[model samples]
Target: MDRTLLEGLFRHAVAQAQPALAIERHLPAPPKGRTVVIGAGKASAQMAQAFEKAWPGEISGLVVTRYGYRAECERIDIVEAAHPVPDAAGEVAAQRLLELVSGLSEDDLVVALISGGGSSLLPAPAQGLTLADEQAINRALLASGAPIGVMNLIRNQFSTIKGGRLAAAAAPARVATLVVSDVPGDDPALVASGPTLPLRGGRAEARRLAALYRLDLPEAAQRLLASEDNLPPEETDAVFANNSVATIASAALSLEAAAEMARGAGLEAAILSDSIEGEARDVAQVHAALAREIATRNRPFPKPVVLLSGGETTVTLRGTGRGGRNGEFLLSLAIALDGVDGVSALAGDTDGIDGSEDNAGAFVDGTTARRMREAGIDPQAALANNDAYGAFEAIGELFKTGPTGTNVNDFRAIVIR
Candidate 1:
């Protein structure tokens, strides 16, 4: 019953952060010239679909999303591509999005439906760089376990369209971006690397981030980072004179709904934070300590309460893991709890996909570790191999929700009863 209710809370959170409910309320008025919708993200397709239904005038555009994550849109063209890594399809989509917005008049309105996963979905490499080079840098960053913000900063230096370049291409036209933030701070400029919203920092800042993360960037990317030409447009640039941004959805939005739902269930709920960021295992350890405190002493808020949080946790790949950050987090939590009674938890990406794995995430309880041992699964060994997916699957506990068609990043809940 705890697991069922937890899943319900997760679904409710996703529903509250959806673009269908968000886009209409924030839609820009119809432009006198034209309304061209262009977007790139895991949720961009759905945002476009929503925009189409909400707009009062004729709208035409295209949006790119990860393969198998596409949504239906009658007037908007939906393109499928790779994610977490760039591909030829993504490169083409990047070029096309720029072209579609180029040469627009001031009377025209460019509505950008932006969301997470746009970084790789629209990879327009720098002047001398190639898509493969961009892919190489992305792989290194993902493996390095750098926070999403730093990774995006480095990516902006090597991309032609990122860091507000997308909005710049549609210069003189009024650009209104509807964003679904997946970053810790809900900065629209960092979502999907801010294709439409320009970042404020310069090349110097990008270099500092690259060195701070010790990012093993490709040769071309390295050169671009060294060159002054890699700098993104300043906040005062004329192209941004009439541009606007709306953070229609985020982790905070979902977390609020989940908290309300928990209260409705007759459980006291505490939202730790909507912007939690750290290594997955480390984060789990901290959360476990809190849960332990509440269970053993009833210190924090007492028993029969739910602790909720939402953020995209990074997983440092030390081994070949079969799971994403959420899996890693749950595996580590299970280890730390080690059969502490009266506690159960669920952690998963709200996008319905956790990292590169099919399962959104998994469930862990006080009995989870014991169950793993009974199934002949070494929880510690599985974690060491980064195989949380395998461990959960063997015990029939992998939480699979498929693609939810919307993304507000990660969702977690701990029910202490």
Candidate 2:
């Protein structure tokens, strides 16, 4: 298998989902009054730039993005903040964005650019909860191995800007949200905790998720979620009737691009699913099983075939080791393959960062496990300690693509030849 081709496929997937390419066509026409753009996410800055380039007249607003992911924009202000975890910078940005949209008229337009990582980029803690409290809960949820949807639900419950409150603030004004979906199912409400969309399952559902994940919330956060006083006000149907959303990019679309790239390389390609989710190691074991079957028996497709999948997978930290779901999945898959010939795979996050690490993910071939063992590294021990980053780095298999500026979650491609 050609590692270059495999890496190229991943790049193609990300390029296909970039905000500059995806956002232009989906942009709505200018409203009768001022157009105020507000957004948050990994792609928010680039999305803002795209909007500015295509708009006929001047537009002013603010957008927050993950630190180091900011793109240049003239009219729209782009602010940098932390991601996958909230920070003080994000908190400040979120507060200012709410003020920007407040007191708008019916003719005004609120163009919201929402995407993956927005939940963290826009952290407006609810009353009685401080930034520290929200950060504590966020860290717990990330370590709890909960799905993105469940985690976002808990985030929305504690946020004043999320759970449709942003849209509510723009009550009389029309809200047009342009989204780049990074979650499975592409549910608008789940993307960036749906700042401009209605909450799917309210506080009750959020409480249920916390209980299910066994997350211990801070005292203030606990009381806030339990209280109904801070709940979002119910808006008339007309308010929502004026709002609209357009999904410019998504995991499914990126997966299809990868499939097309595979076919172009003269290999048969199969997309298992775009919404596969669960524990990283578990999902990897399943993919390994299918790859083994195809390699040994050609049961699913002939040799020279690639299997692809995308979605967010969770990692439950137990061993206090360097971790990222993509790296963990690749390491686990390599272990499961156990030196099976003619098999190579790549797993990466489209946003070009995995967990808190610098590397996007990693690559592994049939010899990966053997090489690790020969290098005096025990793959099993490393995996047991949740140190996939260490294991892959030892064998020079780590993949690093700095700040892709777009995210649609994890991308996995297994090539069997």
TM-score of each: 0.98, 0.98
Tens-place lDDT digits, model 2, residues 74-120: 99999999978899999999999999999999889999999899988
| Candidate 1 whole-model C-alpha lDDT, 0 to 1 | 0.91
- 257-324: candidate 1 lDDT, tens digit per residue: 99999999999999999989999999999999999999999987888999999887898888875999
Model 2 alpha-carbon drift over 4 Å, by segment: 233-237
RMSD of 1: 1.0
lDDT, residue 87, model 2: 94
